[model samples]
Target: MPRSHWLDPLARRVLQATGQLPPARSSATSNNALARPEPALPSNWFLDVNRGSQQQWRELPGCTDDMADLLVRLQRGGVQFAAADDLFRLLDLPTDLAQLWAPHLVFNWYGDAPLQPVRSCIDVNNASSEELTSLAWPDQRIHGLLRERRLRGFRDLADLQERLCLPASSVEALIGRVSFGQRRAGPSLPPRG
Candidate 1:
């Protein structure tokens, strides 16, 4: 039931007299402006994918419990996304869900930063013999790689993989741990005995 028209003025007078809500107090802003409500609170933070915690991801709009846990698991397992595509592909996130959460996600690289392990990211074209050996690759693979780089440096990960005969799985694992920067003409690794 609607309040009677006559009671509207009486209610306003009562409220004003009680000083609960003062009249003319909101006039600093125009009456039209007061009629509109604020849409939402603004946020200024973006989620850093590589370094984001599960809790942080869970706070986003569309993240599920499984998705949040999986994200943490992948990060812990040394998996880092290079972009939105990796997150979508690895998590098998739906297009609509990804779009809903895209604005909040960031894929910043936190390589070799404090508390983040370097994981022996050896450089094939530049690392010394010892550093090259530190990679979990086989002895023959390392020796062969050292020999090939002596003639000419690897063009990129593909070139390195081809020369070493590294399997698809090995190559996939090497994605983030190795980089293919411009091959420097530094002194080559001493010949392995």
Candidate 2:
């Protein structure tokens, strides 16, 4: 057989013999490659506002030297915010700062709890009627409406009511809830203490 005719089949057999190919690069990884670096930490004390107040705020254990230097610079420059806030934003503080500074500062700070996970909508183009109805969307009318809309190729949310038999109100309600992208998985449970 000619090389060109045999090459494709030979390559396929080799690939199949290898079991599975390596996983493709994730979207997050590709996005990170294109993103700019985060802004650098502010080092100049003259620019800080919390310069020299006697608040006796807690510091990260073993970070005394760096913290003291940062505080002194801020105080000398007459900066007027809590050292904690400045440090928090400057370092991109972890979700739990108490854990980071444990045994040093008996962390008494309280803030709003982290945001609850939001439920993402299904991709109307590829979703089955069962999946569409599983969202507790009232009735089969909605599912049939979505199916019809998919066939016509949805241009946008507004086109749903115009192109399908769905009620205008129902279409509007689903507008903010539905998405063209895949649904995200729910948040993972934290490890037991």
lDDT (tens digit, per residue) of candidate 2 on 38-116: 2222232122223322233322323344445544543343222323433444333465652443233222322333222
**Whole-model lDDT per candidate:** 0.67, 0.43
Query: What would the per-residue lDDT of candidate 1 be over residues 43-97, giving only the tens digit for each residue?
Result: 5658898888988887776677777876675566555666675566545578877
Model number with the top lDDT: 1
Worst 10 residues of 2 by lDDT: 39-48
TM-score of every prediction relative to native: 0.39, 0.28
Cα deviation of 3, candidate 1, in Å: 76
- Worst lDDT window (10 residues) for model 1? 112-121
C-alpha displacement of 118 in model 1, angstroms?
7.0
